[model samples]
Target: MTATAATAATVLPIRGRLRPLGLGDVRITGGFWAERQEVNAVATLAHIEHWLEREGWIRNFDLAVRGGLAQERRGREFSDSEVYKYLEALAWEIGRNGDAGLESRFRAVVRRVAAAQEPDGYLNTKFGRSGQAPRWSDLEWGHELYCVGHLLQAAVARARTRPGADDGLLEVARRAADNVCETFGPDGIDGLCGHAGIEAALVEFARTTDDDRYLAQAALFVDRRGHGRLSDVEFGREYFQDEQPVRQATVLRGHAVRANYLAAGAVDVAVEQKDAGLLDAVRNQWQNAVTRRTYITGGQGSRHQDEAFGGDWVLPPDRAYSETCAGIGSVMVAWRLLLADGDPRYADLIERTLFNVVATSPSADGRSFFYANTLHRREVGTLPDADRPSLRAAASLRAPWFEVSCCPTNVARTLASLTAYVATSDDDGLQLHQYMPGTIEHRRADGRELRVTVTADYPTTGRSGYVSRATKLPATLMFLGRCRCGYPDGRPRARR
Candidate 1:
């Protein structure tokens, strides 16, 4: 396949119930999401880059190239993943708008990261150094594979956006993926990352490169989980998702982000391998989580101590640990399942999560961010110090930065590529999942052109509607000219 075909959308399953539209297909002309996308492109992306540099997370790659990484490396063990997520955000932003400056910055970061890669494709600054612990020695918390997962995702973004561009990010990702397959294949380590990101990422890399090996590796990782691969922690085996296999879990458990990522990856594997039972298992898990574990804001992870989900109905408004990353993870799972099953409920949850949780993370100007989104604030909370990074997760104020910052970069990437999640086209007609002021254009399987303009002030004030025009209508989609839906009980309504 050509680069254009493969890198069109974020989640492109080989065969799904609906085909997702790429960043190139939908255009957010104006609206809340449009404003957020602009802020992300202008402010949040730069704000994240400033902090990554200021915090020396990006420089960790440079330190990895130089000696004394153990002494000089700053930030948490998973800090490298933030830089990669920023790169992913940049790649999508650059793809959305061919910004020459962002492209330059993207290439520069990729170069520094590429230089740090070992001769054998091992890439990380947190492990396997002079004074640092050996690589893969701390599977439960090392986050080496987790970092690689983000790296592969960044490469997926770059490949989808720029294709054969000379950035070398795709090559870097390929080498690292190859190394992973070599080291973690069925013949190799029987371990998985403490974190669950690498599973879905490996599946995506495989799709991008049309390589079965990476897909098989992803499946192996998924299968190997829930079998006591990693040593148990205080949070127990379930915290690492080592308690049961993916196909058997009825509901999402453990760390909210990890559960969501694992479910999303499992869906990818199920769809690719045509495992109906596995797909059903994930759908069941998602249904249960949304019904019980989710917050009204569409956020998850109620337990603040371990950053995990409490038992069913354990949600407390005042103590919601609804980490922004977990919100993003839930969207990932929902979006994929929506594509796979063509379920409007999935889209509904996605709309809720994007509007409340994801959008709530970044401040208005896109400078500060909320790491944990609470439904209720008990006290007149203290504002986080703008100059100093906050160590607290449930900080009352949106901090400029955090000690283990993940949400800001995650939000950046999600918003930068938010257009991809807006709409999708199937064999018959177009489906606009998320309402926004935008234009969607697509040709159906039978070659009928469908173009629609959507206008809405949703989750806010004013009316929401879409005006669709089509060359030829499919049987299921027969609408044209001006239309207005979602009106009040007595307002003049037009079918959309």
Candidate 2:
């Protein structure tokens, strides 16, 4: 298998900050983190293929190609998001292990996803059917843009990590993005999806294609948040993060995943546009979240009622609804923040969320996962869902899957692509964030390359190490002590 490093095809929005090593370049070859990723690749990725097929996502694409609109579309409106997320995971797994079968599956899914697209670049199985919701009709609950966001993300993942697979996924993404740009934004619909995912997706799509339209679209979406443009559905306008403008918000309110995903995209927008006020607002919101909203285990979302955030410092461990997807979203936001400002604080939060919330979501063998993750368990109990009695709902335990099933695939993609968050490099040298045993390689456009091996295994052995190999440049080391940096057993405090 090729040791493919994890690098973005184009993190253009924040390229000025620090560049990441490619997928196989930084490999978690051993120790605790490595084992988790290994399980994700072998067990979780394989299991999700079965789940997607069994759940009829793959079949829905086939039906949509024939314009049949089969019963397979019976799943949630955002079922396509799950499929796209799974493909993103597959992209990184292909880079990680270079499994030929997985690569073949990746191509197959790409073809299927492309086949599901309409000529107008509109894609979503939940719409266009006889009895289904009209296309892009409801911005509040319809997830057309959200699905498109995930599709663009999957395409970006494929283009970045699997450059050779010139299948229509990338083109499909471009067409879909063109449709989005033409359909929404200031010159078009002037409407925003209640969900916050499409903003980051458009920004990433802009990075991938070097097109300003998508970037402008991303900025428009980011700016549209918190304006009460939404109809205050479910948990009020705050649930959709439309209560205030992104630049004015000092804390993340609303559904956890939507809020964090929006915050992440806002970081991208702020970094690319060099919007100081917006950037500062996002930074302040992150600080507030870490200090006041986040749990000891690095989880967010104190309420199960809406899967949304509570007031400042309103964290309740026993009733925590810190969905695994939210934890992943938190890491996504943290990583972008890490790139935006070159802050060690972002790295600490990513490490904390990774070790506690994300790591605990998957069971010991990675065969099962958790949807709702809690820090405190009042009683050791299994989920009372009639169909899944063996599945645990909260705390450290996990379930094989859920009816919603977002968390399992989210974990799959996250763990498969975990190396991207491990280290970053600028013109000077690379900065190691989490203490994982791995080999990180960086390739410069001027034909220079640097490779470093981290023997940092403080998780199990309470020791850390690093060594770098370069051709002409010498890499310097900054060793942080256990007391200062931290012991692996304890959670580090986030700076305000």
Candidate 3:
């Protein structure tokens, strides 16, 4: 037979997005932590709350509001910037619980934090106040705006997703965005954060509100990045995209989390603006960094001091301070890039990080969490004061929260948004990237419910298949094979 004819005869029809197994569908394979009833979704949230309380971080709310502080910080006590992450945690906690009181508590916190904002809509507790740190004074390490941007995003999520959730937080975010737009644009403050979070926050705000202005502001920030507008101080011009445009920067640079988050936001803008060049740049950078620079566990950023990317193939697993947040950030970038180009490789990286790096962060009980996850194990490495060794544990999971706990909630939020990354569509058909037994409801262009039933023995084995029932039209199905294509144990391949 001709090659084309032979391929056409054997190819199976694949359809629908690859949805996750959901909390309900996931049946743990081994009888270890998988068998425990406390490992469920509710239990995870409870563990998160307990850790937050134990770390004395939750009390920062009272300090921000009643204590007359300007902004939350990162220490044991209240810090302005840290408060935003705490709010993000609360938002995720509320999302997990679907609680009525949590919304009220969120609103209360928002109102108190709002009071801390100076007149001009500048809403950072640490800076932007007279007789205190000047507003927008420090862009490199300040993180004042980064914190606010996250709060804005949290507000948007709370306002839209939760039932009986008030628009108060949304209003706060709007005001904050307005302030940011007025201050940080062409005619406003000529600076950007060394930590690249606010841009993504701006894009999210725009998405939540359906306002083009927020998107425009976000684009302006992205365009002005790495052009000396944001200043180049500590790490020189190359640190925070100051050396060249994000497109020209071949390898991932600067702080690992910031670079990935910025790249993700840039992809968001590229998709919205249909900027193909920008999208291409993001994909190239992602591939180069993840494949060469990243740790075996899919963690990025080798050095601890800058929390930044190291040289290519400089992945020292033992010294791997793969920040949990960096892994989350890398996943964020990969997920968006997957949508931008329906490539299955992005999905593979996401799965790798989710199972090995991200899953290893949270303790089995879900109470404690590791700021850094390491693959290597040693007796002395487990000691309390080990200078934060990178690959020091085989699977030494920590509590759900920490003194600088940002990863647990970040993981929670990513998992909550897991539905978005499950599938993608092109002109030809839908592609299923990740396999988990679940039901996917896709509204086709012709206004039909394309119901798909996914069945598989995934992770344990590579074989998987889907059955689709479409309304009003025939659906096209496609399955991109898992990263590891061959069967385990080096046996001959088995057909599904």
- Number of the predicted model whose lDDT against the real structure is largest: 1
> Which parts of model 3 are misplaced by more than 4 Å?
1-40, 50-61, 64-67, 70-108, 111-119, 229-234, 383-400, 425-429, 461-463, 470-496
lDDT (Cα, tens digit) per residue for candidate 2, span 225-334: 77787786757888998888888888988899999999989988888888889889999999999899999778999988888899988988788888888999999888
The residue-level lDDT of candidate 1 at 336 comes to 96
Instruction: Select the stronger candidate by lDDT from 1 and 3.
Output: 1
Return the number of clashes found in candidate 3: 24
Superposed by TM-score, candidate 2 places the C-alpha of residue 147 at a distance from the truth, in angstroms, of 0.7
Query: Candidate 1: how many backbone clashes?
Result: 2
The 10 consecutive residues of candidate 1 with the worst lDDT sum are 474-483
Q: Report the candidate with higher lDDT, 1 versus 2.
A: 1
lDDT of 1 by residue, 312-377 (tens): 999999999999999999999999998899877888788889988999989999999989999988
In Å, residue 293's CA in model 3 sits off its true spot by 1.2
C-alpha RMSD values across all candidates: 3.2, 4.1, 8.2
Model 2 residue 301 lDDT? 93
Q: Which is the better candidate, 2 or 3, if ranked by lDDT?
A: 2
Residue 12 displacement in candidate 1 (angstroms): 0.6
